[model samples]
Target: MIIEVFRANGALLAAGDDLARPAGLTSARWQVLGVIDGEPRTVAEAARTMGLRRQSVQQTADSLVADGLAAYRDNPRHRRAKLLAATPAGLRALADVERRHAAWADALAARLSPADIAAATAALQHLATALDQEPSA
Candidate 1:
């Protein structure tokens, strides 16, 4: 299951890259944009939500800022850890990617039985829960 998950992750990342490329964003950048689309959050917060390292998210946020897709705003609660928000352009780009992603997902899901999909989802969740509860090395 773990090996299959690794393979699936790689395939999904490639698909994400393809979906985001036309909009001038990579999978990582689009992911960051999506995270902040709902509401502004600091880099550490976003990283925790995504289960990624803070530094990686920070680099992606910086790139998004440079591309004008996202901007850093003052966090009233935090003095230095500013919140990241998607710009108008970022939202538009994210909408584009989401449309593409939905279509792709629909097509892929069409090939599988709904029952099978649900079982797979539940199994993965169970595995994730067990892993999360495992004692640290």
Candidate 2:
């Protein structure tokens, strides 16, 4: 199951990259944008949320800011960890990718039942939770 999940993750990332290409984004970049969809977070927070390393996320966040897709704001609680927020351009890019993704997903969903998808999602989440609790090597 774990191996299958890993394979699925790779496949999903590839598909996500394809879907995001038109918006001049990659799956990684899209994920960063999505992390701050509702509210902003520091690069560390976004990294934790996405199950990624802070340094990698910080590099991507910096690139996004340079591209005018995201911005950094002052953090009242943290002096050094500035909050990362999606700019209007970033939001627009996300929306564009989401619209494309929705259509693609709709087509795929037609081939699979909602119940099956829900079950798979639940199982994956369970695995993720368990993995999160495990000590790193």
Candidate 3:
């Protein structure tokens, strides 16, 4: 199951890259953008939400800032940990990526049974919940 999940994650990342490329974003960038779209969050918060290391998210956030897609704003709560917010350009890019992804997902879902898809989704959600309950090493 874990191996299958690993393979699925790899495939999803590749697909996400393809889907986001038109907007000049990689899977990592898209993931970060998705987290801070409507409501901006700190880098550490984004990293924890994505189950990724803070350094990785920080590098990705830096690249997004360099590309003028995102910006680091003053955080009223934390002085050092600024919030990562999406600019107009970044929001537009994210919308494009989302549109493309929706089309791709719709097409893929069309070829499969709806019941099967629902069951799979439920199973994955259950697995994620169980994993989240586990204590960190």
Candidate 4:
């Protein structure tokens, strides 16, 4: 079951990458944009939210800034860790991907009932929680 879930997640990420491609984004970049949509966050915060390493997030965020998709601002809470906010270009890109994702999700939802999706979501959350509690291998 765990392996199946992992496989499903990989497939989902691949689909997301395809959805984001038209907007010049990969799944990882889209995820970072989604995390900082409304509220700006430091690289560490975004990393924690995305379950990624801070160094990786920082590298991605820097690339996003260079590409004019995102910008870093001074953070009042953190002296060194700057806050990342989406530029207009980033928002536009995110909006485009979201539209595609929504349409794809709607088509799938039409086949699978909402209750089933909710149950699957709950099950995934439970599994994530269990994994979180486990010690590093």
lDDT of 1 by residue, 22-72 (tens): 999899998999999989999999999999999999999999999899999
| lDDT string, candidate 2, 110-129, tens digits | 99999999999999889879
Give per-residue lDDT, candidate 1, residue 41: 94
Model 4 misplaced stretches (Cα beyond 4 Å): none
Over 16-133, each residue of candidate 3 has an lDDT whose tens digit, in order, gives: 9999999999999999999999999999999999999999999999999999999999999999999999999999999999999999999999999989999989999999999989
Query: Which lDDT tens digits does candidate 4 get at residues 16-79?
Result: 9999999999999999999999999998999999999999999899999999999999999888
The whole-model lDDT of each prediction reads 0.95, 0.96, 0.96, 0.95
User: Which residue pairs in model 4 clash with each other?
Assistant: none
Off by over 4 Å in 1: none
For each candidate, give its TM-score against the true structure.
0.97, 0.91, 0.92, 0.93
Indicate whether candidate 3 or candidate 4 has the larger TM-score.
Answer: 4
Worst 10 residues of 2 by lDDT: 123-132
User: At residue 91, what lDDT does model 4 achieve?
Assistant: 98
Report each candidate's C-alpha RMSD, comma-separated, in the order given: 0.8, 1.5, 1.4, 1.2
TM-score of 3: 0.92
Model 2 steric clash pairs:
none
Whole-model lDDT for model 3 versus the true structure? 0.96
Best by lDDT: 3
| Winner by TM-score between candidate 3 and candidate 1 | 1
Per-residue error (Å), model 4, residue 122: 2.3
